[model samples]
Target: MDCLFEILCWNVRGLNDPAKRDAVRVFVASLRVSIICLQETRLNVIDDFLVMQCLGPSFDGYVYLPAIETRGGILLAWNKSLVNIERVSFDSHTVTGEVVPRDNNRWWLTTVYGPQTHEEKIDFLWELAERRSLCPGLWCLLGDFNMILYAEEKNNDRLDRFIMSRFRQFVLEHEVKDLYLQGRRFTWSNEREVPTLSRIDRAMVSVDWDLMHPDAILQALSSSVSDHAPIHHSLSAAFRPKRRFKFESFWLNLEGFDEALREAWVCDPGIVDPFRRLDALFRNAAEYFQAWGERKLGNIKLKIAMANTLILRFDVAQESRRLSQAEAWLRKVLKLVVLGLASLQRTIAR
Candidate 1:
């Protein structure tokens, strides 16, 4: 049951607007992300409808901490088919849960949204240490920490050595490895004339957790509608079983398919017995149709991979700078293209 395990973490700022919610849905749908962690949702109440609006229909399991007034909310959602989570708990700034991925291994996932002020931030750090004590075994602590571990992480004059030391001490105590963002420097921006950027958002995993997903990749994606870029963490690729060939109904609907099939069926294997001759003819037709379909339809799986690669290129570009109108349009179009390709792939597999 080894399946794809990918998580998307973002400080979406807010999802009150329908557009932002729709944008989230598009991202989830396009990327086929299994787990989602959203910070600063700024929504006082969250329902199934809102979850569907933001994460799409596939993400059926969720837990959320409502905001105080119009600030500081967290939402964690996962696809039920891929992962089963239990022992869920939440406070003002964190959501902790025991996740069982399709591989049937158990691990803790703590999604954090650290405090802004100095005094409250200390308390938040202590709470995180406490959370670690409660969550044993392989653990993944991730999301917006709201604090930088190093001076280079932020492009600003403000540097809090005390807070940085405390965060580092916590990581050292737990022995969690920071799966630092690759290819991009910052995960958040103030979006000003002289923009303020920081790498406060990240994923940290215990040694055991890292062993479980040795090939995991972490990267910051372009933020289209938020101040924070979405960070993607993907485990090893999904295990795909060998595909069994099946006749496609759509093949019969093609223009010259009938003629091709007739030509294929007309081929004789030169057998004497009637039953054996019929069997040979059927096998010949199946082989010919399989080759013909390959030539005419092309490979849906390859197209899906190419589309995903193009989208990732756009996402990485968006992380550093805003994409052009044409590029944005193309990215959006590629999302739909991937979705259709995935559907066709599923149909062929069936």
Candidate 2:
């Protein structure tokens, strides 16, 4: 059986807005996430209907902590088919649970939303440590810790040594390790005139949990509607088939492409079997197109830049004196070529 499971944690800021909720739905669906941990939902309460709308019908069960006034909240939702919830515990700042997979392998998951004030932050750390002690099994802790692990995790700000020391101590005493991140260095940004960035949101697993899922990886996704970027955790050995290359529409715009395709397709070395002949034709076409693309369209951006430079030079020349018939023709041709290339690129992207 495949032992691969994917969990996503995000400080969505607020899911109260319909647009933000839709964005969350789209993002989670795109990733094919199995479990979700959301922080700072800013909703006093979330019902089954709202969960269905936000996470789609796949997630049938959820445990959440309601926000206080306008502050912190935590929510944990899972697909019933993929995970079996053994128990759930929640406070103003956290939601902790024990989940067993179909294979009967069990693990503890805790999603936290640390307090902003220093004293409350200290209390939050100790509470986390206490939870770690209670759940003596493979454990995964994730969400907005509201603090940085290291000085480098924060940008354009002075690191608070006392806070960092305590946070470091908590991790050391608990024997938790970060599931190294990919994509961006920072997870949260203060959307200001001159922004401050920090890696406040993360996934940390117990030593045993690390051994259980050795191939686990964490990816930092782009922040679309919130100040914090979402983090996704999954196993590296997850099954995915190799993607087949498709012919791009832009390739048809290049010179000699038709001739190259025709030559590759018609080159028959007296092969008799229909299946074998078809395979050979396709192989030849792919090879021909790859070689042609490398030689002719090696770098589309560089070619576009060169064309732009030529156009600028001609414009400058026209300012000095009337252009020659050939120069005028060259300008018009360059404009058309630039437009064509840009349009082709857009079409290929889509």
Candidate 3:
């Protein structure tokens, strides 16, 4: 039989969207994996996956992605049956997380959020390479590394020498290898006319993990909602696919809109169109209003889909420590240390 205890790393975006993150979850759920590292939960204090969060009784959840940032960090969930609980740490850069199993287990599971830029991302990868030297033993690093290692990863951009160098360094230094490529090399892209495909998001393992799970395989699900597809790969002796979203037709199902937003998006006609960024606002608002009206969305989640029109206003991290109520609530809700785990429990989109 195929090996079990498989792990998945995905950019779910938000668990609330049925067509988006939820679709990806369905694909992962089919895998029957053990641990899942989720990124870009985009959750707020009020957001909840509800029934979706209760996947496994023995699993422990960790939510390092602050809801305030809504995009920069991550959420991790692991089955207790697979590994004993121990310690977990989120990096100061909001780009890496380390899970050290209890009782001196010779393994480290880290989900990395690589830097976004050409330079920053390489720096982050080197940081990973450096970490490998500091901590010996089996290491499994996965998630949206955000750097395409090859030209085949993107359709138009030639292989970036600098980017390639950094990735190679990490792999060479850590003795890491990619899980078998499942399908198309591209794991992420903006589904547009040209359709950019890049394999920036991936899972990697060191010699130790490779030996333990020689049968490991990395498969990318179709882009359903988010820009990144869900990745399912086996590790050790277990395999569990991420949960798929069963979208119910309801306005509450559509997230973002709080009790019917009546305010129309005001397009400042004064803005010029030459620069794509500045003119994007008006175009999106018009698009949102049109989509909203066409759908006649009654489901809350769908209604919130209109808010997706607001998604382009991307900021790396919201850094909401300034929000007193939000911070207090986090302290009460997330017990990463004593409990040894907590989870944002976001659903899949792409």
Q: lDDT per prediction?
A: 0.88, 0.85, 0.60
Error of 2 at 16 (Å): 1.2
lDDT of 2 by residue, 157-233 (tens): 67777888999998888889987898889999999988999999998999988887877889898887889998888
Local distance difference test, candidate 3? 0.60
Candidate 1 residue 45 C-alpha distance from true site, Å? 1.0
Best candidate, lDDT: 1
Worst 10 residues of 3 by lDDT: 341-350
In order of appearance, the predictions have TM-scores of: 0.69, 0.68, 0.57
Clashes of each: 0, 0, 49
- Pick by lDDT: 1 or 3, better one: 1
Best by TM-score: 1
User: Model 1, 28-90: lDDT tens per residue?
Assistant: 787968889999999999999999898888989999999999989999999998898899998
Task: Quote the lDDT for 203 in model 2.
Answer: 89
